[model samples]
Target: MSKTTPKYLLLSLPTSVVPSHHADDALEAISTTVSAENGSAAPFSIPEFKIGTLDALVQQADELAKLESQCQGVVAKVADALRNILDGDEAQIERMMVVNDKPVDQYLRTFQWNKVKYRADKSLAELIDLLHKEGASIDNDIRFKYSQYNQVKNTLATLQRKQTGNLSTKSLASIVDPRTVVQDSEYIETHLIAVPNSQEKEFLKNYETVAPMVVPRSASLVASDNEFTLYAVTTFKKHSVEFVHKARENKWIPRDFKYVEGGKEEERKEVERVGGDERKVWGETLRLGRTAWSEAVMVWIHVLVLRVFVETVLRYGLPLDFVSALVRTPSSKQADKAKKNLDDKYSYLAGNAFGRDKKGRVQRDDPQDMHGAGEGSAEYTPYVFYEFEFN
Candidate 1:
């Protein structure tokens, strides 16, 4: 009820010794300790992550996610506007007739689906510039961030295409809060418990055994999800703390929120305001500003920022898989000279220069291809291949 009292005890505050996001600091310590023990630096330096870089990137990503979702809502509005104008469905006419007390044909004004993409366009341009400015273009140690950024950017673009299929956007349904199921009570304290899905049945079966630990007849099932179950635990207000403690001891996490001031209904309304009403303010602004799409694009760019930051932390300091391979080129007067140089440079590598089939798959193994060595030789085995065309 009170913000001081965590609705969800498990998520209220971090229980980890080091914060989950402080891997950079942890790595820095490990690297220093290792180097000191060795009494010297290694042949190559490891990529060092910035202190608050990941936090900043994640924050940016959160902003972008909001933009992306809001933009989709805008796209929905635009589609509705266009539909109303073009079709003027009977539903709209009937609704208008009911409201204005006029015949359908008397209505002169119609809807127009305005584009919000233009403003989002400018935001995206600015975001790209920001990434280019702060990106790991320098320092090969961290340059991998550039590659990860590109991957994330490409994926976002692909997802965008998938999101707004056929130039139409559908609004996703708002979440239904489970708290509505609980009845109001003053002397009784109600708590929401989240249990891991793995042991959901076990917890339900043993619910009675644990309920008395906090208060008699305290536990009741409210809702469940694929990953977790939410249980409503009602007990005497004096025993609320004990209930929460016992609940945690049984691996049930208290929902994270302040339910004391106004209780679950107030918390539910706050969540609804955030998800439904408050979120539309931005959507309305985008519709007014004509830049909804632009905001969406900017948010996508922000997603790439997080991708780069996270990828760098997880992969940059680790061993990499470096590779080299011979490439085939069309024979030409220039090709002969280049092929000679390539051959000289990689003479040590085994050659499998047989021509590939039209499908780009390697041809069947032939004795003539490898000469006598082709007999039972793994080097002459047929292998699948792909030809890449660059634009």
Candidate 2:
């Protein structure tokens, strides 16, 4: 409700350390150590994917890791956009991520690793490629849909603005009476003028003498608001331009209007049409946003799983054995504690690749030292780790 997205830490460890029967023990240990009052964890299902050659898997690991970050960013952005569309409702239902039409938290708890959707027969590289392509496609689609909705919404707003503005700027279509307009008269032309409320009596007194051939007593009040009064007047057709100029010089606003049959009705119809268009687009954009968020989250998780599989192989070397998990902390402090506990427990996984500082903590190499390590190797944690938020 406070707009703080729910954060989760994703981790994967070698199977040798966490046997199948005790799979939940590692997560339980981390949660209990972090905050027994607010921390939770679940089995993050990662299907045994086919690992191609070592070189290809390493390259794809780096690419998929970056893709995971991208997917995370896309999910957050789409959530924010959807939140705005919901009128900043802090308690909106879309605060949670969904996958397969189920909330992400529930899905993770009951995860069975959809082997049908992502065939394990396919190489891990192919699966990573597929997930990356889907994530990119979803991101592009959400952007386009949100943009289109804004365009239609803006069009409707512009139309509504003219209906509510002051006399000098508002549309006169619905206010001007057909009978008050001098229609189809060759000698007499009807002109609409907006005079300030303070100058109404002055306009009424001098309108007849402002220009040549003005009809006496032809001026009639058409409409009025707090700041201005609209009046319709008749004058000789030849003096129409001069009449408007003199009216402006006298601090009155001359409005351009062409009389049309059923103009008011037409204005109503136009508003209805645009209003309907805006509503339709709004519904579509909202639906698209929801679907895109789910797709992006799933793709992001898949990329993370791929990173875990590949990194586990590269780091642990082999027989396709590791335990992956999802950890949820109620607060950032708990998240920090979970990270610290996990680091202390798994620092040995890094082995000789990472060194120790005077504080006896595993000192991760700086980005500069990680150069040529790989594209996604810039940040090297003891074990496979990624975090994302959904609120």
Candidate 3:
């Protein structure tokens, strides 16, 4: 407490522990210095000693190291927790079934059984036969029988329909005739169909007896040899027709569609005329192939809100207290607006709080229900109700 006493020693020791004599000595010296500098009558008070530079630096370094260790531990725990959350059996199953591809409903509907049939070299007839052999009676049900009959009828009908001239058994036979076998001239030729009217003509045209062939016009068949070319071409054409029919059924093109000549050129010109800003706006709608701007805006807003909420939770844990405060605040209008935004954005979070499952049925994880204020409900539900309550 002497005038020469070091600041560190004074600061390191407590005020209460400092001797009264020393404090009096320090205060008197400080008062004299202040009086001389200010030339004032008022006595000066000595300020409390502050920690020295070396001590402060050492303390800060120690705290920083401790903080670093704590942060590392927290990071490790979070990583393990996230991995466990993502790698759980249910999560893995959901990831495989839902995330890796389209939803189960979409997969089941869009799955091309026809493509599978073609790849496997299996006919619809063979499939039906196998089913029948397995005791699956497709005959008992009239609808089933009708469906099968209609399919066969349709195939034959399509073939007959495509015929250009007068239909005849001979002509039909010619179209559907299988590939000719390469053999010696001595081998006897087998006739699958011998129409009465064409027997003499058939005998006269024996050397010109061609097997039934379907010629397709697809690019895939362009390089095929003549022996297999017809089959490939026919298959491609049939498939193309089927695809176009399906597209039409799905309303992919307008019913009043007129074939556009140089449509891409027109589109490019329109884009250029519209300039960059309008072009971007037009591009978003075109890219999504839809015209619901409000819905798109809502979706983007929801994504942004969810992203912020997730980042907040990941950084500082769930903001339940802040959310509750916001919900219960006196500014009902602001609260209502906030709740509306949340309902539009985070309704899925609410749905996850209350949802059910049934056997053999695709369960909805989120169910839409009444939300927001002044809707005959005194209590309001938080988005993370289940997480906050249970966790």
**Superposition error at 256 for model 2 (Å):** 4.0
Residue-by-residue lDDT tens digits, candidate 1, 99-202? 02322122111211122422223343345344333322212212233334334445444444433322111101122243533346666656666788877787
On TM-score, who's better, 1 or 3? Answer: 1
Each prediction's Cα lDDT score?
Answer: 0.36, 0.77, 0.28
Candidate 1 error regions (>4 Å): 1-188, 196-201, 208-213, 225-229, 236-242, 257-391
Report the C-alpha lDDT of model 3 over 1-391, residue by residue, as the tens digit.
2122110000011112224525444334323322322221111121111222444434433333333233333323322332332344445433333211554333322322233322224332343233233221211222243334345445444444433333221123223223331123242222222222323243224312122222222212111121221111222222434433443343222111122446545545543444443434333322222112112222222222222222223222322111211012123343344334433433333345433345532233433342222123343342321100000
Give a tens-digit lDDT track for model 2, residues 317-368.
Answer: 7776666778887667777777777777766766665567898876775424
The C-alpha TM-scores of every prediction are 0.24, 0.77, 0.14
Q: What number of clashing residue pairs does each candidate have, in the order they appear?
A: 18, 1, 3
Clashes of 3: 3
